[model samples]
Target: MQMLQLSAEAYWGVIAHAQAAVPLEACGLLAAVQGKDLVSEFFPMRNAAESAQLYRLDDAEYLQVEQIADARKLRLVAVMHSHTHTTAYPSPTDVRDASAFDPFGALLYVIVSLKHVDPVLRCYRIVGGQISEVSVEVQW
Candidate 1:
């Protein structure tokens, strides 16, 4: 299994964004320095779908975040979104969309579940319509 390393701050940032979004799904991007597996930056993005069950990153915002990552010599390591009422696992739509958008199988798909009393965060790799969980290691 693959491992995803994230800073404590970045981990909490994802939770906070999920909580703040409330009924709507929150979306963002995670970036890491090239050649490193540790995630160093989080870019919260606008959800173009603006729905509780669906999310789409705004194109303009996506480009902006990509440029920012490029400037920092970082690569987009993952795409993150919150599930207001679903489990942390990928939904069918997520699987379909990920396969289409990430055909190269380069990006991790992180899902934050707000359905339970405590929010749950999980990471996955979706390629060719197959989904596999990835372990997350929070670094101090």
Candidate 2:
């Protein structure tokens, strides 16, 4: 397993939104800060598709997230999306689509499980059409 260090506040915020989007998948972006080490910050993205079957980052929303990172002088660290009914693992489709969606390889895929009212989040790195578990630590 790999490890992702993130701010405590940001982690909770992501989980909150994930729960709120229950029954539907949630999506968001992560800003990576590089210092002595790497830390990521989560920024929520609106789920435009009420159906929750798909996710797309519009230019406006994308810009908003980018601006926030820019304001803090951070880099686009990762992209996150949730699965409503599936496990907190990447589906085959997810692996196939990851390449096009994230080319930088900095994108860490996060999946939230809606199997219960309280969702569970798991991180993964999709590479070469394979998904590998990534360890994550929520820093308080």
Best by TM-score: 1
Error of 2 at 46 (Å): 1.2
Identify the leading candidate in terms of lDDT: 1
Cα lDDT of model 2 overall? 0.74
Colliding pairs, model 2: 2-135
Q: Model 1 over residues 2-117: C-alpha lDDT tens digits?
A: 89999988899989999999899999999888999899788998889999999999999999999889998999999999999989999999999898889979999999999998
Please report the TM-score between candidate 2 and the true structure: 0.84
- Cα lDDT computed for each candidate against the true fold: 0.93, 0.74
Q: Tell me the spans in candidate 1 whose CA falls farther than 4 Å from its real position.
A: none
State the TM-score for model 1. 0.97
Per-residue lDDT tens digits of candidate 2, residues 17-134? 8777766777888777645235557788877675565555556898988988888888776677777777888877777778677654557787777776677878888877767788
